[model samples]
Target: MSAYSQQPALLDPLPLSPPKKEDELPVALQDIVTAAITEEVLGTVLERHVQAHKPKEPRVVALTADSISIYYLQPVREYWYLPLKQTHTIRIAPLLPVLPVDASETETAKWVAEIKDRITRFTETKDAPVDRFIPPNHWGDWSGVAVFMGFTLLIAAYLLGVGVVEQFVFTTERRFNIAVAVHCGVLIKRSKDVNEMKDLLDKHWSGDSKGRYLWVITSWIEGWRAVSRLRREIARLNLLIAAAEEETAKGTKKESKKKR
Candidate 1:
């Protein structure tokens, strides 16, 4: 017998069958597989598809008492449900043109009142979409940091020179105390300005006082020089008012002299 014939018939390898056609798959399975393949080929295909099909108008849904549900249209059609009791904060952009160049005090007051009323309504409403416009945080700007540091160093140098001058009129301890006192006075004045801003926000933005307070603090950090300039203008206005009163009294005296 041949060597091949000596091998056992049971040891013969079986032939493999051909792969199944995609069309041969069950309808449901075919759809699933097709979707997976499409997703693999086009990254974020589902998100694009949803966006293409989604309605132009936004949808508002009223949630049940213990849970809040959010549906996102982008990155995919997804649903998120969170406990209603969870603390959540709403961020808003600082309203620009806060006071118009030509705006009167009454107009500014009315605008603030309207904003407060809107915020109050937003807090009370359920499942309302809040449009947020976030302003860029300028504290992280390197240019701003450099300018602030330069100004602070200049102020320190000037104060140090003043302290040295005081040494001629005061003891060493007294000179040091005076310098410290002057620096502290400047800071105290700035703090008072910040407090005034906070009070104004509290009066007009009662709904989100914390947010308003934070905005004021950030504004001071970014624009303390501007705040100081505004304070100076107010002082000048007071001086003008006093001068006007003096002029009116002198005119009255001149009229009395003419009558005599």
Candidate 2:
């Protein structure tokens, strides 16, 4: 026998437990099992069912070790995931949920405690990324400077009776248009690249506020174009109506003369 054989045969290593199947998971977590498996982060999922808002629909939330995903099943089926590494803030309400009528007071308290403890542990262990807040400028930035210069130029032009300057600068609508144009021009000139503009907007606005502002600006531009097109169409229609009326009048006069 070889030297290795002389020693007692090593016992077979303890077999590792097999991973849990999707069917074995709790009912609340069954829907997200496929998504979790695809992401390869399907370790353990803790779920809670609660109403998202008072008047809105309820949602299911699955909390993993590294991520929290919310599932909305009404009006539409949607899944949203927020990774622990990317989230910056987590706020839990004091009275998070209303327990079922069948649940005892003690059982309800215990359930709420457990949920809060789990969330607290996960957050303490996996901290979200820190945000760097950029201080906003006072009144000496490029935007401010551009606005001041544009206002001064508008006033000077109005005083000198420049072409349509009084009409544009004195009226509320035209003044608003001029201000919007100047501000947009300044923003474009100040931003060296697309990334810079995005960063600047992110620094100033949080969540969907930035997107909302962009949407409003885009809608305004599109609305202006639509209004202009409608005006042109109306003018063309009016001219056609006038020409038809003139032709009808001429035809009536010719018919009356032939009758005489």
Candidate 3:
């Protein structure tokens, strides 16, 4: 006979045993299955749920006025970027409100304690990027060329102003934008700087900065305020979620006990 079979041969079918009730799924699993079925009947968002759970690669992140970048630094550098025309919410840790403290309260000796309560009621948000737009804090405040057009006497004044701004400026003259970034309402990067990170985008990205200026001023004005609020609101929501999860766990335990 050839190796390939053409005739139907004969083997008796194996007897199948009936499923056992004891071998059935647990009560919790049953409940979950029921809920899932109800959801599917009502038109489930299974696609979005699957997409949300898909694994993501580890990469470095950088942001700019126009786009956010995700890139690999080693193993042959590669980049992935998302363009921005919409406002994104981020939490700024560097801008947390500062409280006045006593220096002598610690083991380390200090002759004087800082009593600046007025510093607590700051009118401007802390660690904001527009801080760079303020005079003295403004860029090229050193460029003297950028600011005063390099007039001989103005140069001296600019240099002196720089010293004053550095040595004597209050806590309000924040000159950087370092924060945790969130996209699509999901927090991604823990520590990042929108102002400083843009240099990387400029270097590696070939995209034009075309539509940036249109919303630049308006967005910059609102940027820090949104971050500050988002930070607080996120913290508040976290507490609520934790409480809900705890309550759910308690209810589940009670149901299991009742079933037993």
Stretches of model 1 off by over 4 angstroms after superposition: 1-179, 206-210, 219-260
Mind giving the per-residue lDDT tens digits that candidate 2 earns over 1-260? Answer: 22212333131111212223331334543343333232111111111111122112212243332233433222222234222221111122121343454877587556546554433433222211112221212343335445545765776676576767756555665775676677567546443334333433343333255453552342233322222222222222322333344466669999999999
lDDT of each: 0.36, 0.36, 0.26
List ranges where model 2 is wrong by over 4 Å.
Answer: 1-27, 30-55, 72-117, 120-260
- Ordered list by lDDT, greatest first: 1, 2, 3
Model 3: per-residue Cα lDDT at residue 132: 15
**What is candidate 3's lDDT per residue for 7-40, written digit by digit as tens?**
2222111111222446333455334333332322
Candidate 1, residue 176: how far the Cα is off, in Å: 6.7
> Which runs of model 3 end up more than 4 angstroms from their true locations?
1-219
Put down candidate 1 lDDT per residue, 1-260, tens digits, no spaces: 22222333332111212223331333542343333322222222211111122222111111111111112232223334222221111121111123354767688566445444332322222221111112333455445546555555645655677664445544566665775676567567667667755553443332344555454654454345433323322222322333344466669999999999
TM-score ranking, high to low: 1, 2, 3
Q: Please identify which of the two predictions, 2 or 3, would achieve the higher lDDT against the true structure.
A: 2
